[model samples]
Target: MTGPDRTPPPGDPARDGDAGAAGRFADFGPPRRVDGGLKARSTRGAIGVSWWSRRFLEVLESFALGTRLTRGRSYARKGQVLRLDVTPGRVEATVQGSRAEPYRVGIELPVFPAALWERVERDLAAQAFFSARLLAGDLPAELEEVFADAGAPLFPSGVAELTQRCSCPDFAVPCKHLAATFYLLAEAFDADPFQLLHWRGRGRAELLDRLRALRAGATDPAGATDPAGTPEPSGPDTGAPDAAFAGPTPDVEPVPAAGAARVLAGLPAIPLDEAVDRFWLPPVPLPDRPPTLATGPELLLRQLGAPAPAIGGPGLLERLRRAYRSFGRS
Candidate 1:
């Protein structure tokens, strides 16, 4: 080899071939063109369903792959990501690009061990607010705190906790394909925060069932809670009617409908001054005022007539009463 002192010059054909190949390699990077046009975006601007999900995307953007993540936002909105499937510790997806065949993307997140979930479930069950919300088909905002207290974060905090793979020529860990999938998952999390929990391996049903069991076991016989996580009344379930249901006592004659109608009809043609006085001076008794008007059972019937009942059925009166009571409170 030392005998080959006569080396090829820099402008040799072999050198040119090497240089040209390098130039061509650079040119053949990830596709920048579109095929069959870009998909229509489902959402405008940033993509996310809830604050937590938005936070998720924010964290993702902070990664070194910021540029690719930004580009992926458009792909996410445009529905370029065709399929997204999530399982315990993994997310798999297909994303359409300039190529005829869609790119494959995968993401893997840390799976909370079963033992950790047991500790978390116990902690969640201890917190009435969390248990109540979870039972009512919701993920409490306070869940983050619970996880923090447990010393186990529920969401991935950084790239080290995540594994991303994309079947694209780009060497970036999270290429555009992966980014699109991430955004889609963000929106999914928004619609149902439990989806995030599900991504971590425990589904809403399983978590709820476990919570219910834990709550029941932890509940003292003296202070048990109903299935809804509300404390049961201390006394026996005395099947007696509620005080509100006691009704106008048996001895008190019911106000005849005719009488109520006449009373309503005769609501004095008082001048504005008298009407104002009647309204403002609660202490002073008005002449023809009926007691039933105070409790307002027939208030709806008086205002809306029989038509409401006729159209809404027997339950309508109770609903209307509740509505009127709510309005009064407001």
Candidate 2:
């Protein structure tokens, strides 16, 4: 929704350039407009587009490079303004320019197939704004015919004659105003690719719905003729019968009433040696050894490899005292 092609002829006055009249594009009903058009949110579109896109804004500022924007020129830096209008088969984007000629450009958008939307999002606009994404990159591969139909190159150079000209006298270089408008448009795309889509008059939700319709139509080719034909699929019979009336079966057999069960006490006992050998044994205490500072409290202090006082438990301090006491005595 940026502007017309470089060689864009003046649009037909009899028509509103395919997007309809100015009033149609500016229709801001309840819940859609906010702060008087500073912000307009579509009720259906998730517009999940990150509330902010750094790269999109960067591209916008990219257009601002070498312009008065770098020098802080106020009027020259004013950005582009955009809006959208949607219909079943068409989307309209109103692209305003800071420079002359067609002060505004109206772009008509046809129902884009689902297959191309992602490519449009990723490689084109980086998915910043749906409408902006539509116009961001060179025309998508799927729509090569459209560009050819319009007699425009897929990629218009910054200085390409195919690029639409401005009424403003500023020549070769896009007038500062045009740059500002483009810069702002890029920012709008950065903010939300939906904006571009919106300008094109096609929001994310609408695009998805159209795609879904197309999918349904494709899947129901036979039904397409009937339109309302509800074809009952001749699939394998997978339906189950009502479960409440299933047949009953014979009961399980019961064991004899007086059957005996073995008791633990009645079992044969093991011999003492066998029992003793098989029983779990506590870990055996190691032979006592003299205390070594390395082992700390775990060290077994002794006269010479004897168990330390109760394994350094009760009277632990007394045991240490005695160890030192023997040092001087003998």
Candidate 3:
């Protein structure tokens, strides 16, 4: 029975329904503008640096709500987002819109339970590549595959896995503010991918310590304890000498008191600056012979175990000793 131009008259029930629809449309009006907000470092091009970060964005874009991200992108580029705080399984943020006060936003993901994380830590410890890189504080690019193999996907698999909300009037689930926060998050992952792991209910230090413990236990299956329950020595023990064996013993030289007393008295007196420069600066070619204890700083330290007030502060004397320690090692 309905046809074009057969519209409900004003003040009618049907007319009221049309007014409600118009009011809902008005809610999507121009988003509030933000000035001096936190701008995305990337003014143009993609927001993420690594493949994982880019993939994160691609996943967001794939959602039915993906097209809404365009407005989010604009907000992000313009730096409309005010503050973003990320924690394990949760993110809280604020985005400045066309209003005097900023809109609050939140995003949540499920934290992997302790049991699942234990399995992940054990399996990751077993992979030499994963362990080596992780110990070095670098997350492997292929780490996602490891999570998949362990039956837990690190990134959100779909919109169902993520819960997003905004205080803005926009009925769109994410609204543009959520999008801006997401773009900023991708940049965060680029800087430190370990954040992704941290978000999954484990922190960098905790995970590293656990991996170290697992490795140590695997290497020492006996539990490394003595009958008394005290920890046994970690280093290898050199068994007692063979009673029947004969080996050449190193010759030991006896110290001559008078000679040692005369050693420091022998060197010619030189200006303090000249002596210090000679000690610090290396020669074009290193000398063929090493400086003996009697001729170098060792003699000074031995004579003055408690250094003079002038040279003692800030461990200046200790540093001099360290300088000589490097000689043999180098």
Q: Pick the candidate with the highest TM-score.
A: 3
- Cα RMSD for candidate 3? 25.1
Residues 1-330 of candidate 3 have per-residue lDDT tens digits of: 111122234465543443345433332334567667778888886788876677677677655443456668788888888898778998888898765678898888999999889877776665455678889878665566557766788888677788888876656666678888999888877787777787778888899999898665544423257888776654565674532232322221221211112233345677877778587643334323211112343433432344567867538767877777776357
TM-score, one value per model: 0.56, 0.30, 0.59
Which has the greatest lDDT? Answer: 3
Model 2, span 1-330: residue lDDT tens = 233222212353212233343532222111111122223232232222332233323333333234323311222232133443434333333333322222332223244444544333322221222223344432222232222233332222133221323343233234433443434444455555555444433575655555444334333423113357655443454674322233211221221111011112244766768678656752233222211112123222321233346676546756675776676466
Q: Quote the positional error of residue 224 for candidate 3 in Å.
A: 4.1
- Candidate 3 backbone overlaps, count: 2
The true-versus-predicted C-alpha distance at residue 22 of model 1, in Å, is: 8.8
Clashing pairs in 3: 32-97, 32-98
* Arranged by TM-score, best first: 3, 1, 2
Q: Please give the TM-score that candidate 1 achieves against the real structure.
A: 0.56
lDDT of 1 by residue, 216-273 (tens): 6553444457899987665777786643345433433332222123234435456776
TM-score of 2: 0.30
